[model samples]
Target: MTTMTDTSPREFKMPDVGEGLTEAEILKWYVQPGDTVTDGQVVCEVETAKAAVELPIPYDGVVRALHFPEGTTVDVGTSIIAVDVASGAAPAPASEAASASASAEKAAPATPAAPAAKPAPAAKKIEGRKPVLVGYGVAESSTKRRPRKGVPATAAPAEDTLYAAAAIQAVQGELNGHGHAPGGQRPLAKPPVRKLAKDLGVDLATITPSGPDGVITREDVHAAVAPPKAPEPVVEAPSAPAAPAVAPAPVASYDGARETRIPVKGVRKATAAAMVGSAFTAPHVTEFVTVDVTRTMKLVEELKQDRELAGLRVNPLLLIAKALLVAIKRHPDINASWDEAAQEIVVKHYVNLGIAAATPRGLIVPNIKDAHAKTLPQLAESLGELVSTAKEGRTSPAAMQGGTVTITNVGVFGIDTGTPILNPGESAILAVGSIKLQPWVHKGKVKARQVTTLALSFDHRLVDGELGSKVLADVAAILEQPKRLITWA
Candidate 1:
């Protein structure tokens, strides 16, 4: 017997599944470290920018390890999961000349200088073939549907019986099953006429069908359901004596002493304390600016039509993120925070842009770390992942912390504008309002333009009036003329 050499194990990194999503939160795991997994088998659930998506295993092997915890946030290109291929399964070997010859013959031709590679030996052939990580692999058959629960087996009905039943049932059931009485009986009416009968509570069994095919039409149902007209009062009433008046009965009263009290837990409790601390510790100053965003709306429409962004969820919030990044670059001071305990003003070079998302739980500010370093496509992907994680209530503590500046899209709720509160430690928060069509003077002519309001709230001690105004103006300018974003970049 000839000996065989094992192929070297390969590490698989988490690929950038979307345009520029740098990281993803691990929602769940499908396979453990010791279990064998097939290529394309759903291995984990990850929350991305757009939605909570299930990621398929890219390799066929035994899972070697899981690098991160279930709720941990890991950067893209990080080795989150590892797989171990069994030894003695190298693609090519020296022995089994016949199999090697067949593989060589089947292999495609190469350049004149480079010879074609040999195939695996016959001894390496197994009962079942496993798929490779990359390129063309064995195609698995589609999954077949499993039998539904609680359904009983029965013999097939005859063809004539089926047809006769359908035809008779159509008439008896009044065209739709909803119009049928408790017992299966034909109301003397068609579907629409039966609807009128039911609305008027007319007993169809008491009425007669007057239309063709012995069907009761709308007029028949109306006539049957209509109430009889009242007769004129008789003059004999004037001869009768007047009746005596009666006193009204006393009304009962209820005690208003009882009260309802609900305990504050989870999101409510967390939000309350955060708001209180933020309000008291940080001196708040808010500034407002109204902008015409006709260009931004047009760009959003174009992005939605691009085939490259087929599966990605592109929205106005993405443009807002890009504008924020550009503004941060110009006015980095707005992206700093006040560290009270340290007795220092911590000015950061990088921007961890927080997005104040209103989730089912409560208000959460899950941020995109080092947002200024990301490209436009990446920012869009990151925004999608951040929103998705927030909605799912899976945002980690690390992601919720270390935010410098934030952008809250209040426009999504159809609100025009609001003075947004600062997130606990962050120095500034920007509120983007709803985009609406309003009459405006454009180029010496009256026209309908898309308008939105921007509200900036910052800590007075850190962000002064001039700095705050400049930052807010920068963001508004980008939105007003989207082409400015490219030049600013």
Candidate 2:
């Protein structure tokens, strides 16, 4: 191993892959300490609330340390890894080294006095440039410090060492109820920890920090919020010899043998929140119709043999999606969202068609942009790419936003029908049931034909019963008569 004498490590902060996302959980790390990395080499994969994204190192260097382990959710803009950019560089002059040692000793005293230490400095501003992922230009938010009494508007870089020392001392003072003076330095903690403390009404100044570098953690906040245990009763000794004390039962038992606990994070956590919000906020009205889609099924087979769509995916869903798009065109008011704040209804002229896909991580609804503009062949190609990318867990965050309507195909799993909920910010969702051969009257004769059930759920706040029914009836009519796709278009 080569030793560097005076080189400083470069810190690579976690980038916000999804705009406005506050934190991401690290899924895996590709490189470790002492591993050499080059520019644009992926070092880790992280999952934000929206999707999983791979982060690459911006410059070539040897990794010095990883700040957090896998599964830890870190705030955006926090340094996750440090790299020795100038490894094997020449040592500093003796005079410079001596001066550096003196400065270090002065800045970080053996016993820190919180009253004398200064606040840590704000991040340096790079004029005309914003913080970004390695290649993608992403927005970087300014660091948010907890509200303190007497912190200065700004601080110098030289105060960083003193701040660290003061933070360590503050942790000890927290136990003694003398953490920060009325106008002294603030306690050290991560953004999430601070938020948790705020939410639980716990004071950070009173909790002892257990994290490295004297930083407060989520567990510290929780411990502070919990009530202190009652002191055990002190029983008087009996005249006779005391009997053997019974061992207490285990306080908690791990049922690893019968049940496994999986942490809900990343995509799954976001999906749960969204689902709950959508369910409670929207008054959903569902309309169902069972249609004989024999002609649509026949057309799907015929499209599979067409030379123009030779490489594309042609399935019943493709036709059903087309029918829905046509139905929206006929009843444009159904393609709308209720703006609660504005007290208005937003009717969209364009269509962003979302398809609910189930992945190993969780269920995700990625949509096609401008679906109304795409032809049949183009739509098929887009659907093919969407399914392939979702299965590989590489769907981008942009592909999942701005959806005006959604389709959930429960038929794939042999479900007959389901009342689907609207995606948040969307007005309608169509659920397709399994298509099977059933006895039907064709030209006054009973015959076996392909039939399926379609259920359309809409936000009743803006979509009245009549409007919802018209859209559902239109979709069923088009599916039953496959030629309506061309006629309606």
Prediction RMSDs, each to the true structure: 20.7, 18.0
Candidate 2 local accuracy as lDDT? 0.72
lDDT of 1 by residue, 62-88 (tens): 888888887676787787787775553
Q: 194, model 2: CA deviation in Å?
A: 34
Q: Estimate each model's TM-score.
A: 0.49, 0.64
TM-score of 2: 0.64
Give the winner by TM-score.
2
Model 2 poorest ten-residue lDDT run: 169-178
- Model 1: weakest 10-residue lDDT segment is 150-159
Candidate 2 lDDT over 463-486, as tens digits, reads: 999999999999999999989888
For each candidate, what is the lDDT? 0.64, 0.72
Q: What is the lDDT of residue 204 in candidate 1?
A: 63
Candidate 1 off by > 4 Å = 1-259
